[model samples]
Target: MAGDKAVSTVSKPVMRGLLNSSIKRNLTVALTLAAISGVAFKQLVGNERKRKYAEFYRNYDAEKEFEEMRKKGLFQSC
Candidate 1:
């Protein structure tokens, strides 16, 4: 197809430039960017999960629950 040929021709120069350039440096930059973005994405997700857990536990009554468990004889006297 003419369109396919045109697209390939357009891309050839770009690909050729990448191949002719400092490939190691380009790869390093790309890898560094990927690592940074990955870390940022992980941190974002982790922070969101932490916030959700914190919000969920904000109204939790740990002492009351423990007392109830003790009253139920769930734990031995220590």
Candidate 2:
């Protein structure tokens, strides 16, 4: 009976330790994923902003050229 009690006690602590380690490992993985996702989101937002600025400049230049052509009478005003 004493031997059986000693075995059970040892096994309980080992099981608890395994459970704790598993929890810690899972938490670490979750945090790493969250950080990666945040960085990706930030990069996407920066790219979108750059795209918008480029489009704005392109449109602005086209409008300026159109005005200059109008002043030069290239396009007849109807």
Quick one: best TM-score, which candidate? 1
TM-score of 1: 0.47
How many steric clashes between backbone atoms does each model show? 0, 0
Model 2, range 49-73, lDDT digits (tens) per residue?
Answer: 9999999887787777888888888
Over the stretch 1-78, how does candidate 1's per-residue lDDT look in tens digits? 768866643344465567657788888999999999999987999889999999979988999989999989999882
Residue 6 CA error for candidate 1 (Å)? 22
- All candidates' lDDT scores? 0.84, 0.84
Residue 48 displacement (Å), model 2: 1.8
Top-lDDT candidate index: 1
